[model samples]
Target chain A: MRFWILLQRDVLVAWRKKSNIYQPLVFQLLIVTMFPLGLGAGAQTLQKIAPAVVWILALISTLITLENIFKDDYEDGSLALYTLSGMSLPVAVIAKAAAHWLTTGLPVIIFAPVIAVLLHLPASAYGILMLSLLIATPIFSLLGTVGSALIMNLKNGGMLLSVLIMPLLAPVLIFGAGAVLETTLGNTPVGHITLLAGCFVLSLTLAPLAAAAAIKVNLE
Target chain B: MNKIVKFYHEMGSPPSFYRITGHWLKPLLILALLLTVYGLIDGLFFAPPDYQQGDSYRIMFVHVPAAWMSMFIYFIIGVSGIIAFVWRMKVAEAVMMASAPIGALFTALTLLTGMLWGKPMWGTYWDWDARMTSELILLFLYIGVMGIYSAYDDDPRKAARLAALVAIIGLINLPIIRYSVEWWTSIHQGASISIMGGNSGIKEWSMLRPLLVMALATKFYYLYSMLHRARSYLLRTEQNKSWVSKQFIEN
Candidate 1:
């Protein structure tokens, strides 16, 4: 009950501010367009770089907004009264991460297939690409919450969040990009996707707990 | 053992820590410098050059130790971080916070020297060898700890605790990241240039011996620098406290 309420409040907050959803989407689209211009519109070239390019752009998009996950609730004193509201901090962190993934991770996963097609990513790899994104992005959101909770006190948090989370995100990026790269090279992407899912499961269980601890520390 | 433990307990006091570390600093620094000089002279001149790469391979003495220290320091940070978070040990917090830049330095040196080594061997300065990529990410982790520490500078103790948490998190993530990176690199390229290819990464005893000496030298350097940095950190953060004021008067 508390989880739904907090999750709903976050979603509602994001909905009221249309830019929260819209800006990242636009950023994703702009990066997709910029690649061809920068890398010179060679279909073969773009196709070759497409898997990494698209996945990295998705990572950056998530990074750009990750700081806001805990900032607003923290600033508004909601997180301070979290224990008083009879909600466990870890459960609340899970709810917050879910809301963030719904807003940020979903759009990127849904949109990655389209960008993959535009960048001439092999048609055979599309399913694996989307599948990888579907598995990996939630972990990204979860890890971001872990990073966010630790640095929520910072007024300018964006850069610190990247440095903290980017290294942690490395495996996700590798497996996510590798799944597509594997399929492009005519191999099964099962290994890559399996690893991605493993990362997801691990982060799912651990990230919220870590974020909860971090939030408690910062609030106190 | 009891005496050592008691000594540690006494050293945990800020004034004692400052005084003891100050007394040890010169000896530690001199020991590190002497070992480093001997290791360099022996490793560079006395140790036989690689038949394949010749004199250029000597960079490995410095590069490998830096690489080792880069990883080793993270473990120290991780242990210190756990201590800080679980027990709220002020000394552990100081150690964790003070270690970041030194860790970053070693990580950067590992990359810079690896690149220099790579240009001759791999025919390119940067090709994302598994180790190099991992070191680069490790550098980011160090910078992240430092950045978070500075961001919380107004509350120095809290900053250390928070930075310690970040280090612990990064430590947990390091292996997963290393696996993905190594797997990804092998998929894209092959196994990296082995340090001792023919010897299967265990070099001839002649080569191995000085490398060990250099590694020992680096350990001393780390101890020297860590003690110095932790002392300065203690002083700066504890400046308003009476112990620090007394030290100022004596100085």
Candidate 2:
């Protein structure tokens, strides 16, 4: 009820801010493009490194999106207003996380295949790559919310957000990248996907509570 | 029970903790020194080497414990951070601050020993293997928490609270480090069923006994050092207070 409205409000705000939506996409594209240029234009070389490059770029892009999650609203006192609006702060936090995933994370997934092709990722592995990223990126977004909430009011919040969040995202990176690599090698990606999906489910269930608690602490 | 509660209350106060537990520091320090010496001597020289790995396997006695403590300390930081976040408990935050450096130290040791062992056994010093990579990330996570705590210029309470948040967030890596081999088809070998099941196999009782002693000793060393560091942090943070100042002058 209230959560959906809040989620809608978040989506509306994000839609109105085009740069906010496009910056990470552009960054992801730039990172994906640089690898081919740097490593030479050999298809074999690109294929070899595609999984790592794609996952790393995805990670950096996700990290970049995290900075704006709570910082803008907290700075503008919208968070305070939301708190005073008689809505559950936890629910509001979860709604913002969902909106963040839809706007920021979903674009990365949609754009990943294009980058995948550019990196010479096999047409065969595309299904597994997309599936794994679809499952993995949301967990990154959800976990990033906790880090963002923690540093929401800090000076140079964006850099601090990256340092605080990257290590926590390591497992997702490993499993997600491993899944893609497994597909590349003609091995079963099922095990990697299962572990990643498990991680995603666990992070989704737990991260909102942690982020909500962090926001409360920041408010105090 | 009442007396124990009273004792806890007294110890909960930073000044009292320093005054009361301060004397045990030296003895505990000496005991830790002695136990470490004994464990190293026994582990390095006397224990029969593994049938498969030979001398390189002895590195496990050091590497395994250090890895265990790294994960153990991170859990302490996370659990204590929860308490501090939920209840605003000052002592818990103090304990967390104390645990961070020690955790970092153990994490470094784990990596160092694992690399040493790996070079001899795996023929490589480094691999993107699950356990090794996850452990590396754990070290970075510790550094992040400690760095954030020190970077802040304002109220220690606020800084501690923020660091607590970082600790809680960073805890996501702990399980990953612990179960990396199980969760993924890692290059690292899986945990032996015997160790996982708490069964001692063909290993001599003499060897197992020393390892257990060393593990217990390391646990106590962590406690003693954490208490010492916490007391020092409390003294620094509370230095301007009358109670701390009076206690310092009296001592």
Candidate 3:
């Protein structure tokens, strides 16, 4: 199908730029390292706040890369061609968001355990933290597509994209962090996990349509 | 029904909308001013002090009404946004864009007044209470809407449509955000006043009457401000149209 081909093409294109993959990883690790430096490296304090810290780092690092989702294709005029190619725009949006997650979000999840060690997050929370990120980061990428599409034509859209999407992302941050926090508190994280999955499903269904609309608007 | 449909059709024209809203603006402003003056006087001095908090609770007169306006204006923005996006009506786009700043203003006022009252009663200026957090997010949503509109300065039509999309999305997310925050935790007190009349929010008629008056006043103020802004927006964007030029030349 064209969807898989488009997805593959995008992933391959991003993979060629090796720095794009490592930049967010390095950024996430650097931020993960800062908490200990600033918070005095106390294990108890770090343990208590580790989940939140990890989530916040993921959020910021992801934000750094979101504008790139549409900017490169937009600049090359390929986005317009994609639109006119008879491919479903929302389908193209999904392909782009998937590529985004594969490149950026997946790497963060893979490295989160190593980052978790720096903050002294307990062994018990490791699974829940990863599970929450697994469900939550795709929502981030989905929402990012909408934000990126909305301002793809602008010159300084990076910061504006964050302002536009962060409030919408607040619920995800809350439920994702809450799940990990619940795990640390020795409670059932099932409730938080379910709510997060709900959010993911909702964003998955709606965000692509919204992004497609925004892309059309920008193209006009 | 025919008259209503006719009016709707006529109002779709920017010139007609500007003219009709021009007629309503002065009266709406006067009514809003009169009601606000009376509401403040009656609520501040005449309404009995709360049995527990005494006079400190009076801030609710302003705070609660602004909070209501904030949410109400956002509802209007979302409805107008749907109209703009689906129908591509210029007036709907103008109205949607006009409502954002006013909504943000009211949301900020609500937070400010709430914080001022909180300091006296709860001994802190801010808390992460569910309502407070959700209200804060509402303010950000307003700012985001406005930010997108201004970012597309070169293409006003595109700006309006894109901003409408953002508003529509935010409207859908508002409930989700509120629910997630509530699920996180709630320290704020539950609603005291209900329209269904089953519970006690404000038992005193004197207090309730003025609060209602203030609420009405804020509604009028919102209409006045939104129309004023939309009229200006229409004039600026439609400057090349004959009606816009004629109105300017005649005035």
DockQ-based class of model 2: acceptable
Candidate 3 residue lDDT tens string, B1-251: 99999999989989999999999999999999999999999999999998877899889899989999999999999999999999999999999999999999999999999889878876889877776888999998999899999999988999999999999999999999988888776412444222213326688899899999999999999999999999999999998899998997899
Query: Clashing pairs in model 3?
Result: B192-B201, B193-B201
iRMS, candidate 3, in Å: value is 0.6
**Which numbered prediction scores highest in lDDT against the true structure?**
3
Using TM-score as the yardstick, the better of models 1 and 3 is 3
lDDT of 3 by residue, A155-202 (tens): 999888998998889989988998998889888899889999999999
Ranking by DockQ: 3, 1, 2
lDDT of 2 by residue, B48-92 (tens): 877766777777777777888998999999998888777777778
DockQ comparison, 1 vs 3, better candidate: 3
Least accurate 10 contiguous residues by lDDT in model 3 chain B: B187-196
Runs in model 2 deviating more than 4 A are: A1-5, B48-58, B169-173, B187-202
Q: Could you report the DockQ of all the candidates, in the order they appear?
A: 0.84, 0.48, 0.87
Worst 10-residue stretch by lDDT in candidate 1 chain A? A77-86
* C-alpha TM-score for every candidate: 0.96, 0.88, 0.97
Error of 2 at A218 (Å): 1.1
What residue runs in model 1 are displaced by over 4 Å at the alpha carbon? Answer: B198-203
Best of the candidates, TM-score: 3
CAPRI level of candidate 3: high
